[model samples]
Target: MKNMKKLIIYISFSLMAVVLFSGCKKSDFSENYYNPEKAVTADVPSLYAGLFKNETILPRYWNLYTFQVPVLGTYTQIAGYTNGSGVYEQPNNYTGDRWNDFYKNVMARYREIEKHYNALTSADDKEGYKLFLETAQVFVYDQATQIVDMWGDIPFSTAGGLNAEGKIILPGYDNGESLYNTALTELKRISDYLATVTPNNFYLSQLKSTDYVNSGDLLKWRKYTNSVLLRLAMRISYKDEAKAKSIVQGLLANPTQYPLAEDVLDKITIQPNSPTSSLAPADQKEIWNGFDVIPYPGAKMVNEIMVPTNDPRLPVYFTTNKNGVYNGVANTLTEAQVAEGATNFIFSRWDSTTFTYNHLLPGILVTPAEVNLLKAEAFERWGGGSAKDAYEKGIRLSIAFWYGINNISDRVEDKVEPPTEAAIMAYLAKPLVAYGTDNLNKIATQKWINFTIMQAQIAWSEIRRTKLPVLSFPNDPTSVAAPNPPTRLLYPSAERTLNTANYNAVKDKDNTTTKLFWDVR
Candidate 1:
């Protein structure tokens, strides 16, 4: 077993070297080959570059179309494409390489970054070294938590690193509960580390430039860290209400140390390298043109909810069809029915003129609207501020964000005008929109709408957590999978073959029907 594991690791490293070094110039190859030690140690910039690649979120063509768009989008009821041949018509048929993507690609890079940072000598700038480590920790928490959310038990504690160092070749799985606890501890450590740095330091300036997400703005990173902390806390609220409330109250109490994203400008976004970068999801000429992930607003999101509530940002969210009306197809449609291309059922695609389709639009990591909605829920459950204020703020921020994405053209025939303030106010005045003591449903539903195409994974996570704006199951009686939506993704086949012992231990528990640790529902 050990010999086989060593062989696998050797092959994996050789393949990785080819992938990493194939595109390098002659000069680049010489520099790396002659100065091997320097090459390993001087990799902080490359580490940051690897982290900012945006592949984990955007992914390749197969993962995007098959897994992310049709599977997750349909499950969350954000968007629905043609369910041709019932491949994505049910949860059981759904599968993804999310496990391998995180473990082999994302987490492996993070571990390498950590190893390089740790090897730094005492002569190295201590503050600079600390900044890199702390920043990496924050990202590790973000990525790892998402993995745990998707799959209940994961190889967290002993997953990444080169096998020669005695790191587990077949690491055992850790349950979600223990992983969440460790994540909270790590988040607190990062928060504490950030608290030590004073304003106008040289180390601080260097740290800022290394950050691709927030551009070294420590305040923004601090807020982002707190926001993630809040999200994790909320995730385990059902099982560990006391711990959740304590973290929430502590963060709320110390706004100076831990600020929240109060406005859309403060929201965390990853800027694209250029107009034709993969980071831009809407850049049709570049990446998006290759895939069918172009989202149509879901019917439940449009006709049943947004239309009934007279949601102010409808125009900004969806384009108008040839008839100048917003319409969405049902997810339950048969493959034959979808292929027929019925005109009345055919819905509008995303607007090309808006930032949604702009090649340069920054990839949103987390939004103020989402944080505000989370705040509203936290406040309702455990007092920190007025739930009503947070709820209203969340709605207004979401509307304002979409409005900021495009210019207001008064061409009434175009069916794409920014809603007037009066229109927004009137929409909010509706009994359903107005906040009440029992308004968790309202908050969750509005958050779902705000997520749309921007944060589909998060929308799915929230749906699993709250089950708000209850979506209907696919009505196709011929569907092969379960009647209800899947609560989690199945473990990837690699785990079954490569790490059979650990995989078998949890295989029975790993399925679409199984709820994650935090998903009490």
Candidate 2:
């Protein structure tokens, strides 16, 4: 009897344990930890794209502030690079942060736009979203080509895709020239398509409503597309002057053809503040001097031109401090400026941030000033348009834009401190003789200064091309200095590890100062 009783109890306990174990197993199995589909969404396209547009505040931080404009932000650093100053240290190597992010997020958006457009059989839906998609594509090409230009070959055809039978497609680098040609073709195709298509309310409801340009107006879209064509032609000017000239002639011939951005307002200004925008980080301030961050304009080209011409833009561009002192750093200042310079210079930390927001990035897109400058540059090179006329026009537009005539900047001087159009025009018309190579360099140099924030890349590119705005490196650490202005960015290290085949293919020609395929000289 005792043995049977014990056996019964043992059986009961065994059954209970098994039941508990099964329940626990079911609970554990219910949790979905390995979410592969979600992870795939996180995959980025290219580090290059991220530099221009991305969710990370870091993109703006790096490109807009650190890499893009930072070169102009601090004088000492440039001096260090130029003359090999002992105190300077270079930033981390260029990586494909922008590229990766673009693939991850932007590509997805493009796919969605494509899907919607393809689904629409009618002209209305087709034309509407098509323009937006095409523009996005242009931006993508601009960004991608820029990336490949810096890094050499990159995964092009196979980028942002699932391989055959759902295999992962890690592509190899395409040729730089091929990529450039492709970009040009893509821009042209889109421009052509836009010519016939007229987007109506279809664009309004297609995507994020606010992001649509011109309310899907195909005419304006066509203009923008042609404007891009002009930009591309200019980009390859160094390598293919004939092509560049032809494209310029085509663009110039059409007056109402493609409306260039009339002023700084035509450029898109991102408002990263209200309800979380993506413009630029509001917290960050442009560092000038030691307090917030050091302000720099160490490009020798700019310094020489401004000092010699007695350009008024200098005071407007840079501030000494709260005290309104105008001398550059005593050590870096020229002998004459140093003699007359203010030692007790004071700049506003507030101004650093304010100046960029208030004065610098008003419209935030290609401006008429840029078009005029480009014309001036092309005329100077090709000898058709009046170089002098283009030069004066560039200066006048730039000065006018800076003074808020274009609604770009608003300077308050207790009463009326902003520059008047007449004052700016008079300044540009100042009867001063430009002599020697130094004087000619002044034209490009002034254009360079006027291009702050909006077109640093163009300025940098021109400096590389003309070498006119004679610039020097910061007199700091020169370990990894480019002998001169670097024409392109080096490929990010990520390429080597993940996409070794592609990265290694073009590694040979990835020099910082190496010209693009079209850069014949």
Candidate 3:
């Protein structure tokens, strides 16, 4: 209890500390954002490093325990939950945490970088810092995309611009589709600019030294930028198929111009490192949650799906039970049933080395599997290329991606070896695992299985869109909360308290049951 309190306190202070430079709230904009009083000025490299260090992409304590496990993870069945009261409720503080992290930790540092780029006088002068400016924009845009997907409309056009504007100003809520369009437009421009723009030796050396995410590789940034565009393009597909189809087809049509992270090795991940050292993915544990309770593999995900199909990622995703076999908790389990399973050690828990305790787990942004899966969907739907080829390649890459992650992190517990080519081929040939029968279900199911709890947010969003690997939830008749999972999260209560007028604009769409514009199925 004491340690839990300390963890909460540490997280509380950490959240407060980061926001000293953000204006997610109108009042915070005064002490937060850029106060000339605080002397927050720093070079582009320093500010870029600061932005890169945030653990939004990592499987860390706050994001996992506070947000994913309780909300998105349960909603998508990536993490196990029981039939209980308040099963699908989105807590105000938990949703607010993500909002705060983006505006303060992410956008605040980004705004500072923009401020530096904006200060430059000449076009040639701007050229020196252009790489930093544009690359950082890709990251911020990606995070913003996730935020908009979670909430309908957000303060985008003017969220953290107090540094740029140099005054206290309340930002307005921008339309979600409009925000998507803005990011898509700028992402393409940035990718095009990088394709031709060459940085001189001096600035190149500076970027190489200071750039935490891509190391001085403009090609990686270009791939990452286009990949983010692909994600957003696909996300809006059902609601706005015309725009989605054009972007998806165009990206796949020109591989050289719009290169994607199409191999397992090309995952955009940040490794763990110290503050004084280069930026890395911090391999920290989620302290507040019980290891025994939360990460248990879902009943259908393990027993009904992976076990039947012989998934290579099975061991990486979960450990065998005491009976020396894999099993997941049944969704309909009562408190007694859950207790019985736990007492008997019958349920497969998440693999410690690859997930829970692995110190080498890097923060993931984009992956080859994700890009290829998107390609598979695009080709399968629009028919510019071979869908089967893309689909098979995506499955192969997903298996290899987990192996790559495990191999990179030194095994503390027993290591899970990568499967052979023969095994992979056989798995793919299986009647249940094979492509073609219910192709959309196959695609969506594979994507969801590969995502696991590691990419909970994306897994949830994708599942909501595709409604694949269909699973059921038990009703909590005694509970006051909704019987089923929510379509979206409720906005944080703080938004109404601090940013009321702006919050009111979005309040009409604030109910958790209200679907986003793209959720049309």
The model with the greater lDDT, 2 or 3, is: 3
lDDT of 1 by residue, 466-507 (tens): 778687775434455644567877776667766788888889
Query: Who is ahead in TM-score, 1 or 3?
Result: 3
TM-score (all chains, Cα) for each model: 0.85, 0.72, 0.90
| Model 1: CA > 4 A from native | 1-41, 58-63, 81-95, 163-168, 199-202, 276-287, 290-294, 342-345, 406-418, 475-481
Count of residue pairs whose backbone atoms collide, per candidate: 1, 48, 6
lDDT of 2 by residue, 1-521 (tens): 01222122211110122222233342332121111122222111111122233432122434444444444233212211123242223243423444454454345345434544566687764555555566667656755655554445666655644546854456666777788778877877887676665455545444333342333345555555566666668778878888888877766666565455434444332333331333333443322222223343443423344445556555555544556443334234443443233233432122333254342233234455666767766667776767677677667667656544223332344111456666565566554424124445666666567766445555555555556555544333344564334556666665666567656777787666666665554
Supply the global lDDT for candidate 1: 0.68
| lDDT (C-alpha, whole model) for all candidates | 0.68, 0.48, 0.75
Root-mean-square deviation of Cα positions for candidate 2 versus the true structure, in angstroms: 13.0
Query: What's the true lDDT of residue 32 in model 2?
Result: 15
Question: What CA RMSD would candidate 1 show?
Answer: 5.7
lDDT at position 101, candidate 2 = 40
lDDT of 3: 0.75
- By TM-score, highest first, what's the ranking? 3, 1, 2
1-521: candidate 3 lDDT, tens digit per residue: 11232222221211223233332454344333333223354566666666676656755577777776667778888776776667777777768877767776677677777877788887876887888888888998998888888887887777654545555346778898899999999999999999998888888888886666778888888889999999899999998899999998888889899888887667787766542233322334442242434768778888888899888888887889998999987778776787788889998888877776666676788888888888888888889988788889999999888877766655545777899999999999988778887877888888888887767789888987777778788776775656678888787776786678878877889886889778887
Instruction: Give the candidate number with the greatest lDDT.
Output: 3
Query: Cα deviation in Å at residue 448, candidate 2?
Result: 0.9
